[model samples]
Target chain A: MKIHEYQGKQLFRAAGVAVPQGIVAKTPEEAARAFETLGGPIAVVKSQIHAGGRGKGSFKEQPDQRGVVLVRSAEEARQNADRMLGNTLVTIQTGEEGKQVNTLFVEQGLKIVRELYLGIVVDREVGGPVLIMSSEGGMEIEEVAAHSPEKILSEPFDAVAGLYPYQARKLAYALGLDATAVRSAEKFLPQICRFFVNYDCSMVEINPLIITEDGQMLALDAKVTFDDNALFRHKDVVALRDLAEEDPSEVRAADTGLSYVKLNGNIGCLVNGAGLAMSTMDLIKLHGGEPANFLDVGGGANEDQVTEAFRIILADKNVKAVLVNIFGGIMRCDIIVSALLNAYEKVGFNVPLVVRLEGTNVDKAREMLLASGRAIIAASDLTDAAQKVVKALGA
Target chain B: MSILVSKATRVITQGITGNSGLFHSQQCRAYAAECQPGVDVFVGGVTPGKGGTTVDGFPVFNSVIEARKKTGANTSMIFVPPPFCADAILEAADAGMELIVAITEGIPVMDMLRVRRGMEKSSARLIGPNCPGVITPGVAKIGIMPGYIHKPGTIGIISKSGTLTYEAAWQLGRVGLGQSTAVGIGGDPINGTSYIELLKMFQDDPGTEGILVIGEIGGSAEQAAAEYIKSHVTKPVAGFIAGQTAPPGKRMGHAGAIISGGAGTATEKMAALRAAGVVVSDSPGGMGDAMKQAMQR
Candidate 1:
């Protein structure tokens, strides 16, 4: 659900929030053309990826090359784009494996008089959305909160009302903005907060929110993420999802109505509920086995979904063992056992498999699995399943 | 002496006549009948516009208020769909139900946030907009947990998941320990009731001796619960935090089960629980054992 900086800016601009003029470029030619079209003395070519800390990120191919660079001309923009596009970017947020940059954003550079941070998140403590502002911009907010808590100012706002204009003005003044910039923030802050609520955004962050030389406030960088559960109401935002930014196994699992997160391990987990699945993974890790992926078939998954889940789990070559943990409540264990048997027949498990079934008709499920005898280990409980999976992997 | 519902608890089902609503309603009634000879704890149902009607031998009312008034139902279980489930919960709250159990899932976080605000003005305590509801072993079966696995006893359990609650409950049963009341707090970021509330209730309930809390990665719920346990709880507490192997920022199936902002990780929650003198179980399978160990100490 994370969108690139350019896409975020597009959302921002569409919402009437001030942002530097920008063009999304997919190639070096497009980036160069965008730079030329802007006719700017200074333009920024930024690699478009979901993760933050892009400015400090470096290209893997050319270690010296930054993912984001200021270019003065079309040729320089093109050269930077050439180095950035189709290259892997490693950032503090992206980890060492990095992400492939398939898109570039060319934006007109501005003379930033002052830099501030603005972030809106669903605060667990507040039980609603809260807007956090800090004068220490362009730095990690968590770090700022840790080192200098006084520098951060936060206010919880009603989701329907958005951030009040007076509150926005207060934050602007606290950020050391001039009278003119504070006036502009009354409009800018509330408008952006409206954009966030309207889009069902889980997070909207603008780091280094700049005051231009002309005293206008603009979002220098926008990092936006929408609530996945709220995507049903906003198809337009769903269309903005970039599959290139996600794991293929995860994307495939989602298409089949499964919640799958790929990890670097050998044991694959298939559980009914989120907490149980996580507990199963933790137990596997506790027993000295790494989970290859976390897959939850959900509460009421049927035979087809189970089969697809198996296909998706086995699709990962790194998966050396498979553990199926289904805590069937209203969904009876006997029915889920039949589904598991059917899925096992279709998927043809190559790795050692352990299945833990609990709840309604559990005895029936155990008998059915034992009768099927398809090279699957039936675990007695969660710990038994974890131990069996770890043992199967020889961990 | 369960914390919430018991054999004497009368229940009303909202969104009854809907597939899941009617089905679980009947199942809950059947469980109560089995637990208490010839008695149905689920008195009636509410399906708005279906008043003065009967569905599957259970009288249907137009509203929760009508059902509560007519059947003397003091608790309400909701199975309404996501969009309207929040309103259904508020309706139950408005009707002055002592306890409202919401079994519906996928209720938008926005709706839950609104529900949280609305509940602040009401006295009715709520549990699970996306949960398995409450079960007091043989006394009452209010929501969706399979009734067969639970047994009546003194260990009070609170969990953020449906099936994980079952896992812990069944594990306790296997170890010859039983639950006084096992409550699913639901696995959403904005749940109606949380660990702290249920933990305090369990701490005060005389029937409940040991406490078991099952939590996953995400939010400060576990941390807050641990802090409460440290400051106030005198009962032995056994705890388990899932998603130890979970990667940062990945939502592990549940919307709330994500490690965000480099906070709300399994390690942090585990440390908090351990520091609070809680016997934190490393394996989900060891929950009952953890409780046994905690009680022994």
Candidate 2:
């Protein structure tokens, strides 16, 4: 689950992280009020979406403007906010839908002394949460990683032992911080770790954690992603989940308790297991067709789950065809076939469905499906099924 | 013969008195009895509250120690609920059970972390806290896997993935290369047993002649195991890492299956395994042929 930049910053601020004073505005009137309230000579108007790279885009800053006159004179900022508010702003960092700008964050702009990247993630190899610090920060962190990987210093913390005092100071040292800044950063690490564990975050990144001319470290931008599975434990964090930012198909699939991820393709896939579903998608790609979505009905998929799965798949507008691949070990094929037929009846799918069912009463499943004669195509092997789906899609 | 479990290995089912626990335990006992005549592989069980009760003629005990003492059951399979799974595994581990298979899924990551922390100090080995469990062909079935498909043979199987194990085993069975012992270590982000641990065990077993490993995206467990196999294991090994083309930054089946910023990909894992002199399968179906070719080599 992802939250907007302003939300992340708000959470960070609540945790005592230094952030520029800001207000989330939904309209030009609210934006004007935010500009006036900040009372700074300059203010940055940023589109508050769950995306980065907004600064490079049309989002602008009005410098040295004062009061209601500044609000009136800040035409470009108002126009940019107006243009982005209801529309999807496509930034380089944003994937697919870019990000829907429902609100804009108006903040006091600062004169930065230095920009740095700071992030914390669960390191797979280290088996603990690790804080990554880089002197070179902001949008080019990816470039820095690709070009000069050694610049990023990783400090792993044992959650049980907590973040060590020495490790925090070391991370601060790695970031080339001054003594005061080191002390402040040292104080910040425990709070960040606390926030990470308390919020069940998968990642918390602050790009361009800038040092102002006044020598205070201010987080200019924040990106946070919470663990979806852990959402059941954190209702407050779950409430922060922005449904508007997610794909409709995903939202609908979540409601049905099915794991669905939309992809750019024509063949809609529904498989029992996640690995099989992924393999089926790979096979579809290998056979010269794109998989429209990754839909796993999970281990126990009854008739209703199957119906809901179909409903979610059919909801994808890009889906030109459908593929139902079941490698039933514990799951019965005859039961899946019945569910497929029932789902087809309820949803009245217009696209072609190419199903490959195996294991546990497969013959009975084939018989039931063949008897239906509902224009559903059946193939024996995964390759053949993928080929058939691709051929049907004319890919 | 199998490595961990065989006809002579006494079994105890932890959480045996619960509905699913009793039902699956009964199924396992019935299957084991049907597999061979006078096969006393399954001996007794444990359920905290229902200690004195008899579950299908097998005496249940209050604790793992009591169960082990009474029945001399060295192997224990857990069917405890998600909340109690970690405790059950810990209890079994603390009891010094030779092998423990936890079929319970959704165990909290924190609990498992602590469980793993304890497991590191213990002598006992754990298979999963969120897996289908393991099956040693014709000897003992300690999982939810349908016992009919398996036949005793030389193909030693290890997998971070569960469903792919079933698919690979089914294909191998079709090609007349049934498993010696197939273990689904599971795809949980924080699991107990790893590919390296299982691979080492499989390498040592005399009954196992060849090995097949089914891996997925996420951790470098497959790569680590491949490196180990290349260095130490003399037997032929085949590998298949799933999610070769999984989209970037998407969580697949397991929490561990996330590919962030293009790291720990299937391609990377496959490349690593291939570079390590392990025969890597192009698809799930190719696993059997890959093993055959590896054996030939």
Candidate 3:
């Protein structure tokens, strides 16, 4: 689950981290008032969306050097906010339709001396929470990692024991901080670790954590992703989830308790388990077809879940064909076939459906589908089923 | 001659009082009874407050300690909920259970981290907290895997992804290379065991002639295991990595399966395994044939 930048800043503030004074405004009128509350001559206006790279994409447009007179006034800010709200702003970070701007952050602009990247993530190799600090910030961290991996310092901490004092100091030293900045950075590390563990965050990143000319550290931008499974524990974080930034098919699948992720392909897949879903997609590609999505109906798939799965797969516009691969162990194939037929009758699937059902009750499942006399095609092997889907899609 | 479990291993179900726990526990008991005559594999159980009760004539104790004390059960299968899964794992570990297989998913990484920290001091080995348990075939089946697919044979299997275990086993069975033991270590970002952990076990087991390891894009667990196999293990190993269809930016299966800036990828893992002299298959269909060839070599 991804939280908006403004919400991430709010979480940082709650954790006692110092951020620029800002207020989230929905309307242009609210934007001017928020500017008034900040009492700053030069305020930074930012679009609040789930994705990053807003500045590079022109989503975040600063006032022209000619100095547009109207934007300085309250009425001008109102008109600007109104025009931008509800409109999709395309960024390199935001794929396709860009991100819809529902809210804007009016913050006090600061003079930056240096931009630094600071983040905490669950490092799989270390098997603990790792704090990533770098002198280079604002740019794609991945580029930095590839070009100069040594620029980034990863300090892992045992979550149970919390961040050690020496570890925090070590990161502060690695950041090459001055005396006061070193103390400040040291103060913030443990707090951020606490925020990470308590909030169940998969990643908490502050890009362009700027050092003001006056030598004060300020978080200019924030990106936080929470663990979706841990959402049950934190309702506040769950409430911050913006469904607009996510794929509609995936959201629908989530609603039906299915794990679905959209990809750029033509063949829609409905598999029983996560591992099988991935393998099915891989096999489809190996057989000269692209998988449209990864949809796992989970282990204990029943009639209702399978029907919902079919509905979700059919809803994808890019899906030229459908592939149902069920390596049934705990789940029965006859039940899945009946559910597929039930969903087919209700939704009236227009695309070709190629199914490869194996394991328990496979013979009965094949007989039931064949007995329906429907246009449903069945294959005995995964490769054959993938081939059929690819040929049908003209791939 | 299974790896982790056999007919002599005593089993206990942790969340045996719950709906899923009770149902699967009963299924396991029935399977054990049908597979072997007079085999008291599932001897005791633990469900916190539901102690002093019996489910299907097997004793249910309050704690793992009591279950171990009363029934002498060495192996435990967990069906606890996600939130309490870490505690259940720790309890079995603290009680000195030799093997603990956790079937619960959605466990928080923090909880698992703490549980793992505690487990570092204990002698008990952990299998999974979000996996489909382990099966030793014809001996004592400790997990939720369909007992029918497995047969006592020479192939030892270790997989990070669960469903691929079933696929590998099914394919291996087709080629007459049934498994001695199959373990699903799960694909969560933070898990108890690694591919190397299970590979070491498979390497030591004498009945296992060859190993089939199914990995996916994620952490360097597969690479580490490949290095281990290259240096130490004499037995032949066949490998297949899933996530060839995953997009460059998208996460494929597990949270750990993100290929950020091109670090851990299926192609990279495959290359590493191949360089390590492991037979790496190109497709899931080729897994059985690859294993067969590796065994012959």
Candidate 4:
């Protein structure tokens, strides 16, 4: 549910939070046109990806190019966009494999007198949304929390009553804003808090909440993450999702009603529940085997979804074996067995497959598997299933 | 005596006319009927429109107020859909139910946030919004977990995952360690109850001899529980956390199962629990043996 910086800025603009004028561009020509449209002497071309640390991130193909570049001319903006778009970006957040940047945000650069941080997060321990303000900005909040905890101040607001004016003023004063900037922050900070509550946001961080030389407060950067469950109420926000930034297998798994995360290993795991799937992976590791992926064929999955899951797992060339562990409650075990058998018949499993079925007509599933005689190994329980899968891999 | 539900506990079902509500209600009712020192757990049902009717011989009331007024039901189990679950919880709280077990999953975090705030002022204790509820084995079963897998003994259990709760209970029962009560606190970022809350209850309850916790990667609930156990809890406790191999930042099919800001990883939670003198098992397959080893000391 993490939105790109451009999308987050759009939300910030809609919420009356001041942000620099920006245009999303898909090509170098578009970047040049956006720079001209802004009438900017200085523009920042930021790569649009779901991860953070973009300003410090570097492109894999062009080592000289950064994910976020500051250009003094329109031609430099176009050049930066040309080097960034369709290239892999490796940030602290994006891991070593990195994500591809398909779009760029060409925005007007601001002359800042001071940069501060403002973030709203759902603080579970506090039992409500907490507003975090700090004098330190443009750095990872975690580092600030670890090294200089005293520099940060937090205000917890009641979800029902929401952030009060005094709370915002208190935070503004705590961050040591000047009188004029404090007056502006009094209006700006509450709007951000209100935006967080109104939009069903899990997190909203405006890093480098900048104070201009003229003493006006503006959000220089924004990163917003919405609650996935709350997306049902806001169709507009759901449309902002960039599928290209996500793993294709995970995207396909979501469409197919399965939860799948591909990893580096040999055993492919398909389990019913999230907890059990993770436990299954750990069990595989304990049996001296590594899991290639984590797949949960959620409750009430049919034959086709199971088949789709098999195809997705087999698509991974590193997977040496498949482990199917299901403890059905609402989803009957017999149905899972039928789906597995049907999938095996259609997909023609090349890897050694181990199946463990439990709960709700489990005996019927075991009998069906035995009668099929499809060379699929059946397990007595979770432990047996893990041991059998590892043994099947000849490890 | 169990921590929550026992033979004396009276239960009411919300959204009883719905498919899952009606089905699980019957299963729970049948389970209570066969349990030792048999109890009638399903006292009434609540459906907004279908009041005064009956679903499979259980009386249905229009609202929680009417249901509580008629049946004297003290506990309410909700099986409503995600959209209306927050309202259902509020209704039960307004009706003065002592314990509210929300069996519905996928409730919006905002709704839970508001509900948690409202419950802070109310008297009722909420168990879950997306959980398997609570079960006092050989006494009263109040959730969707398999009744056959549980047995009444000395071990008390609290978990965040539903099936893993069953998996642990089944494994413990296989090793002759029957449970006193097993509770699933649900896998939501903002749930009503926490491991620390239940740990205190288990510490005070005399029937419980040992405790088992089934946690996952998410939140600092386990860390908080570890801190609580260090100074407060005296019982030998064994813990197992799921998602040891799960990649960071992924949701892993549960909303509360993500690692954020380098916190709530399985390794971190396990290290915390181990440092608190709680035996922590690496694999779910070895959880029972770990618990047994802890108890032996």
TM per candidate comes to: 0.96, 0.91, 0.95, 0.96
Which of the predicted structures, 1 or 2, would earn the higher TM-score when compared with the native?
1
lDDT of 1 by residue, B158-258 (tens): 99888888888888887888989999988888887879889889999999999999998999999999999999999999999988999988889888889
Q: What tens digits encode model 2's per-residue C-alpha lDDT throughout B51-80? A: 888977888899999989888888998988
* Top-DockQ structure, candidate number: 1
Clashing pairs in 1: none
Model 2: CA > 4 A from native: A58-80, B8-23, B36-72, B79-84
By lDDT: ranked, best first: 1, 4, 3, 2
State, as a TM-score between 0 and 1, how close model 1 is to the true structure: 0.96
What is every candidate's C-alpha DockQ against the true complex, given to 2 decimals?
0.72, 0.50, 0.69, 0.65
Candidate 3: Cα lDDT at B56: 78
Question: Which of the CAPRI classes, incorrect, acceptable, medium or high, describes model 4?
Answer: medium
Model 4 per-residue lDDT at A327: 81
- For model 1, state the Cα shift of residue A47 in Å: 1.9
lDDT of 1 by residue, A70-165 (tens): 999999999899989899999998889999999999999889888889899888777999889998889989999899999999988898778888
Question: Alpha carbon lDDT of residue B288, candidate 4?
Answer: 87
